[model samples]
Target: MRVIKVVFLFLLIIGVLVLSFLRPDDYLWLSFILALFSIVFLLIRFERRKMEARELVLLAILASIAAVGRIPFASIPSVQPTTFVIMMSGYVFGAESGFIIGSVAALASNMILGQGPWTLWQMVAWGLVGYSAGLMQKTKLMNTTWGRIIFGIIWGFLFGWIMNIWGLFAFTQGGNAVNMKSLLTYFAGSALFDSMHALSNVFFLIVFGNNWLKILTRFKRKYGLLE
Candidate 1:
């Protein structure tokens, strides 16, 4: 299981790197295919382990909540609870399941928000947020309030940076090579939204952190899932 996990994660990383160079209007579709396959393949391996229907339903519910959480905040720019929810899900469930929920949430939300090449990056970004949190499940960072707040704050900017990759590719057309000024400028332009996202993450974590943790932890214990 660990070996398979490494392999698919490698593929996903390669996909992201490839996207940096590929034209979003042209070849990003290929990167999306790569990421999609990684997710499905990893999920297939996970499901083959004599998993229960309850586990599947739990995952689906988490993904749905994350997706729906994005809608009400759609009018508020970068202030949304989706990232916080996905991060919490990953933190409680462990890495692979966290990745699954994050990826599914992105795909589900984009179905309503409208999908494009950008959706792939959103999956990558949010999935990483969850995966990283799960990786810290055994660490002090995942245990302390300040540490969890820091985690949320960091991912807020990261999620924005990941999405910005799509923006860089999509707008830089006409066969023009991407340059440093363009990269810096693009990121600078998005600083406000990213900061808002980061702040919102902190806000959500402060308000809902303990309660959400208890709820998920209770579910995990009661269902005997993801243990």
Candidate 2:
């Protein structure tokens, strides 16, 4: 199952890379279709593993917390606690669990907030944040205070950049594909939102990161879940 997840993950990256370069103008729906399939496939693989009841329960709790956590921040533009919570989940649990939690959080939150083509991109971006945070746990990046701080800051911008792909695709105003000028202008306009995202990440990660990790780690250890 791990092998399958890794293999599919590799393929997913390659798919993104290919479409990024090729970007067949008329074939945009294909990206969403592929993403939907990939997400579904990942979930199926997760389920097929005969996930423990406790693990499922834990995933649910985390996803719900991440989702509901975003609601109160709606008035603050891009500032939100969702990424902070999801990133911690990934950091302690490992990549697959992080991705699942991140993706589910996006989906669940949008149910209250509203959904659109953008939701899928958010699911992917947030999932990647958690997924990468989990992967970083094995590296020196997660070892020190500054390193983790840097991680949160970087993903703040990265999460915005990921969503920008959808913006470019959808808001190009019939340009059909992104051009250098439109892309630059769109990104420039979004800079404030992205900056807000990155700064908010640093704030939450710096202030609440350690405690959240300790609490989550304690729960994991007590339950012997995600082992």
Candidate 3:
């Protein structure tokens, strides 16, 4: 069952990428929405099987904290602590918890900021960041403060890059397939904003990364969650 879920997720990502390029312009939004919901459904199903009641509640609280972390940074474009919270949650809990927190935080924040197709992309991108962090939790790289800071920097850029895909497709000329030129142009236009995000992520991680991890880890131990 686990293998099947993993295969499904892999194929879903491939399918979404292929369809994004191949699907007709008129149907692009619809296709993306469908794909987004499909992925969410699968993730929820997978999580439901492994998570207990207490774990679910804890996930909700952490996700709320992550989402709320973005509020104070609203004045500063492209800068927020959402990523730090998600990464710390993943580092302390596990990949599944990270994925849930990332997904939930995106949804929750968008609810206040406004929702659209872009929300889906943000959820997936952030979720991937958290998931990757969780996967690296046991490694020496994630175990060190410097390594964690470096990881934050990498993910900040990566998240921006992934989110930029929505811009690429949204602005493409009707019926024109997204190409290298369009992709590069989009990325170039958003380079500054992405850089700010990357820098802010590094700042947050450097300043608060260890403290956040310790708090979450201590809480996890106290409650025996996700053990």
Model 3 per-residue lDDT tens digits across residues 107-166:
778779876656666777777777778879999999999898889888888988887876
Ranking by lDDT: 1, 2, 3
Model 2 TM-score? 0.83
Question: When superposed on Cα atoms, how far off is each prediction in RMSD?
Answer: 2.7, 4.1, 3.7
Tens digits of per-residue lDDT for model 1, 1-227: 67777676867666665654554554446445644764574466566577778888998899899999999989999999999998999999887778878877888898898877777778778878888898898899889989999999899899998888768866788227579999999999999999999999999999999999999999999978877
Q: Cα lDDT for residue 16, model 2? A: 58
Question: What is the C-alpha lDDT profile of model 2 across 1-227, one tens digit per residue?
Answer: 66777778768755754454455552335445544654575466557466687887888899899999999998898999999998999899888778878877887798899766666677778888888898788799886777888998888889988888777867665457678988888889889998899899889988998899899999989988785
lDDT of 3 at 58: 83
Give residue 182's lDDT in candidate 1 (0 to 100).
90
* Better-scoring candidate (TM-score), 2 or 3: 2
Q: Which stretches of candidate 1 lie over 4 Å from their true place?
A: 1-4, 16-48
lDDT of each: 0.82, 0.79, 0.76
Report clash pairs, candidate 2: none
